[model samples]
Target: LSLSGFINIYLQKTFVSKQLSNLLINGVQPPPLPSKKKVVVDFSSPNIAKEMHVGHLRSTIIGDSMCRLFEFLGYEVLRLNHVGDWGTQFGMLIAHLQDMFPDYLTVSPPIGDLQAFYKFQKIYDCLDIKLIERGESYYQDQMVEVVKEFEKKGLVELDEGRKVVFPPGQPIPLTVVKSDGGYTYDTSDLAAIRQRIFEEKADIIIYVTDSGQSTHFQVVFAAVQLIGWYDPKVIRVEHAGFGVVLGEDK
Candidate 1:
């Protein structure tokens, strides 16, 4: 087609899209998904109490765009902010919280005020971001089961006293559980994937992190695949990784 003709057609399509964008549904019928689709987007998981830097900003912007696009397409999107609220660091945080709020140690201590404080620490009063804060600690029990099942199935092998799974083609073998029987990030990540698949019924689970975690997610997704938790034909798991930030001077 000629350049002018093509431009005219594209303009018409764009105009139509803008017109129908607000009409999510004519009546009770809703927009269509490509297929049986539930998406779980894991993103912007800054460690608790840590400062938000360039890395966090990049992740948030990229992930939010992805979520917005998927939601607009009528996909059931689970926006999972995989916050670092688990493991020993949390023990330290809890100790500090207890020290500051001594009543935390007391029997039938006050929690209402603290809870309210957490809930209201927002950017603005009138703005609604619809943020639901759920800690990774909430999934501790589920992670235990996930690791135990791997142990039971012999899917993991011990490497120098640490339970690990060396998925083929990956240099970094995933640590299923520590020598002390504590779960590692590998165990927790796989467990979260299982939760998204079975409980949330997510057909596509995406991890949006820096390229550093690309291999990590590969192994986690592979572990789930090996465990028969998901099939590539039926479900999809992806790692949408981004590059590192460097000073312009460098």
Candidate 2:
């Protein structure tokens, strides 16, 4: 036999021996090849006081699959459920709670069932998906700082008394703050992205939602790029948007 043929046989035997050793030692489990990068996935963001619909379920499953894949690749994954826990609607709920229980501040009211936020936790547990709850309300205070950052960078423009940020190439500007001084979804998303980048130190950020919100996230991502939050070349930020789930009425 030639020298090249002998070398090929030896290499094939070595590969087979390694596979046999791995099978005996680790069974069906694959060895972990650790990576340094961190990934943050935002998904299953159902609003507080609302039931989990098919859209939320689809996002949850898809996001969990992505997280598993990342983990298998040894990338650090932060699973986030960015629930809609704040806004004008919550303000009305708070007012009603205060009226029902005058000492709401001192004594915890039994508003758990009414809020319906914890109900989703059970579903998540059943799905065996681990996630950290970082709702919009968590960044309510940080939204002010977000607006300040935009203003400091001279990216914000006053459009008829509302604070808006117009991303390059986008015709409509994102309303970060309304004329009534209330923060919109744009403000919360900005704060969340900043936190994930600067605080969470995520090398990659993925937002999983329905296709209907594709433009909204595109605008938010563009605004973040404009604000100099993270270099697009170094950090990967994307929207894993899926098709909308419609009823059979149509």
C-alpha positional error of residue 52 in candidate 2 after TM-score superposition, expressed in Å: 2.0
Q: Estimate each model's TM-score.
A: 0.74, 0.82
TM-score of candidate 1 versus the correct structure, residues matched by position: 0.74
The runs of at least 3 residues in candidate 2 whose Cα sits more than 4 Å from the true structure, single-residue gaps closed, are: 1-35, 95-118
List model 2 lDDT by residue over 1-250, tens digit each. 6555344434588899999998998776745565579999998888775556666889999999999988877789999999878887788878988899999889998866755645767888899989998888899889999999889999888989998899998756899989999999889999999999999999999999999999998889888888888899999999999999788984
lDDT of 1 by residue, 19-68 (tens): 68756555334467557478888876777655455567677668778887
Q: Model 1 clash pairs?
A: none
Report the poorest 10 consecutive residues by lDDT, candidate 2. 2-11
Candidate 2 clash pair list: none
